[model samples]
Target: MTTKVRETQICLVVFIGLPGSGKTTLCRLLLEFLRTSCKSLSDILHHTISICYDELIPADKFRYQDESSQWKQARRGIVNYVKSLVFTLKDIEVLNMVNSLEVAVREELLKVVQNEKKTRVYIIVDDNMYYRSMRYEYYQLAKLYSFSFCQIFVQCSVSDALNRNSSREQSTAVPEEIITRMAERLEPPDRQNNPWEIFSLTVPSEKWTVAEIKKISLFLNNAAEHPVVMPERNNEMCQESRRICSTNVIHRVDIMLRKLVGDRMRERSQTSVQRDDLQELSKAFTDLRHHILEGIRTGTIIIPEDTYEAINLDQSNCGHRLQDFLNGLLTIS
Candidate 1:
């Protein structure tokens, strides 16, 4: 008599924190623990894959301000790659361009797809996802694919992060300013506000221990066993999901507008623009941003069905609108 093979389970484990918060260290430890613990289960196979954005994207690409679009493209590529892996490995070109480590992981994933054994696949995404929008992307992906989704926030004090960063090698160490900025902007998972982030875990890095690995493993196992379920159309859950998406889009747009305003102020200051005039320009941009956000929140501004596309579209439109307003002001001045 042949034993029945259990269905394959897939989970997307996202790590969010500031750089030097021990996210990478915790990921390594968790993967090691999972692999070792799975050794005794003959009928079960556990496959853990680590996808580090730092490894996938070149470090220098992040230095230029204008490269934000490219950064988004790289992020989109990672999401697409994960989608392809979860559904079907049809993007061979993407597979070809990835590094050797990712290539090996893909090969293993392919085996799991072909094999008859009961397998549990865990894809750990290692990155400093300081924005809630960033984590929401993976949550959406998990919901779309009916895969388990969980976030691990490796919390560390700014002082601790700085000390740890200082101890690192020159090439590997992140700049102090960058770490400080990230810590300030870091939006750790809030399960109360964001219902979708309920599966998240916040681990204080300083208090982390070998015992924590067992706890993490158990959490991951539970997540895998219960994947995200897609909400029915026109239901309260669906409406709430839309609200969350809109909130994320608004937050992202707010960040973009602030950056644009700051950049413009800096440029005008260096071009002999009067101090009063610069203040006026800043005020105009701030007011316009507030108006735009209010319109979005009040349902006066209709967001597109595709939230991601809406973000880029709205951002471009806002930039042009802001520039037009600036041009009018310059002409009047």
Candidate 2:
């Protein structure tokens, strides 16, 4: 008799640190570490992990409202939220990252959680732990969801982090005031809640070093298949991501098809009313097509527009006709 193994519940990991604090670096490392660990322990060869960044959420729409338990996902209309998912959500109009803290957490984080049920996924939250000292909120989340998580803080001297960010070909992202604010409120993790074993050089029991920086870079490369944003480039990345899968990008060449054929067909018909009769219109069109086909087939050219205008269209539509339509729909893609 063969025993079937049940699927393991997914683990959610959230990293908190200020800008340049190395949350993004740790996230990359964790992805590789998680993949290796899953394979070794479960003997699952093709294990999958999905990492979602908090700032990448379309925050403008899901504005962070005042603190209230009612700010749960159900606060919005069902049909409206679904419509947002198809376009308005992904192709966000506004690009601001500020939101009501609690509400932002609920709506955006929940969206990530719900969308990640496709496989044995690892949900990584890449936010600096600038707010709450203990990750009790995360722990409560884990308890509610029947899975656990680890908090990794990439500890560094604020000046050192700030300096490292400055020297990179890239740039550091946080405003000076926010960095100062985070530092003032920063709390080093203690023993009882030693839940998150931090890593710097090797989980940072002290401060960061040149060797730690190298290790973190190596780790992030293994974590993700895509170049997800690291906060500073969040705006640029979000727009590019939206464009890559945009319907507008894919359909631009056919734009005139809508205008010339069906779009302006009504206007085109008025001009064609003087063709005397359907037979006359059809005969003129036949000759035009014949001429156009000869140009394409024989390469003599110069006759396509003569054919097009003979069909009662104009120079504006030199190549876009029935033939062009066929080439678009069937041949050239």
Candidate 3:
């Protein structure tokens, strides 16, 4: 007798955006809308993980304050808000992500492709996914997993983000320098390079109406069924995945930085300079490196292990030491 097969579908949606840009809020709104109209989305909407009690300040737009009391209140708000979230990738996915980003992103994604039996693994990524390097890593993961990818670009004015942050009493937020850099790196999503569609939502004077929320919910329902397949690129030389073992976010970030500010940064050391002067050059590159990384997802540098060793840039030990050396460089020129 012939045996029948059992196939189950899994829908995954990765919501990426700059910090404090309203990704979580939109996700919440989307969930609220979905629960009422689309059963599929409603089912998943119950699993949101609040990052903070008040709100998540976009990394690119975060600010700092000196008042201790005010800062504590904002922190409390974020914690409370986080408590309200229904689902969090924390225990299952995020922990794995922190432990071994390379394995979590690359290996897990590859497993999905290699699996001959599993039907569908739909994942929805909900975070401030503004970095190109980070997004590229996920894109590479999708390619490895053979899973389709799409994008939902929520267009919000700076005023809106600032206003929302103010209401939350958040005295700290992603820096303006980072936000400026992101704008420089920002590339509008479309059907070409990523074939991932995008939607720009303009908040009505204040709150989103129930009907509008419902519309977003319906959209997610339809999107889950059919994901966008990335388009193939020609003259593809930069195809090898980044080698860093950190989370896709950090790894891709480092890769982008290295590419942007390669070794011999001061190759033309002005009027006169000795090889020993490379330290100054390295310092310059590091500062430029961080600022550049903040703007673009992927940068132009590509330093291998050999180069890291030669320049004494140890990935394992280059934590605070490296930051201290390059702190001044991260600033925008």
* C-alpha lDDT of all candidate models, in order: 0.70, 0.40, 0.42
Better of 2 and 3 by lDDT: 3
- Candidate order, lDDT descending: 1, 3, 2
Greater TM-score among 2 and 3 belongs to 3
- Ten residues in sequence with the least summed lDDT for candidate 1: 324-333
* TM-score: the better of candidates 1 and 2: 1
Question: Which candidate has the highest lDDT of all?
Answer: 1
Better of 1 and 2 by lDDT: 1
How does model 3 score by TM-score? 0.44
TM values, all candidates: 0.68, 0.38, 0.44
lDDT per residue, candidate 1, 79-176, as tens digits?
A: 78777766642222224436687777867666566667778888899989886766777877788778899999998999999999899998788889
What tens-digit string does per-residue lDDT give for candidate 2 at 189-293?
A: 543323222221225423445566456534432332222222232587654543343333223323433433342235435554564554454454445545444
* Clashing pairs in model 2, backbone N/Cα/C closer than 3 A: 16-128, 16-129, 17-128, 17-129, 28-220, 64-100, 198-203, 199-203, 200-203, 200-204
All-Cα superposition RMSD per candidate = 9.7, 25.6, 13.7
- Which portions of model 1 show Cα errors greater than 4 Å? 1-6, 39-43, 61-67, 89-98, 234-333
lDDT of 3 by residue, 36-118 (tens): 44433323322211132223333222223311235434433433332221112111122122323224343433443344453
Error (Å) of candidate 2 at residue 149 is 1.9
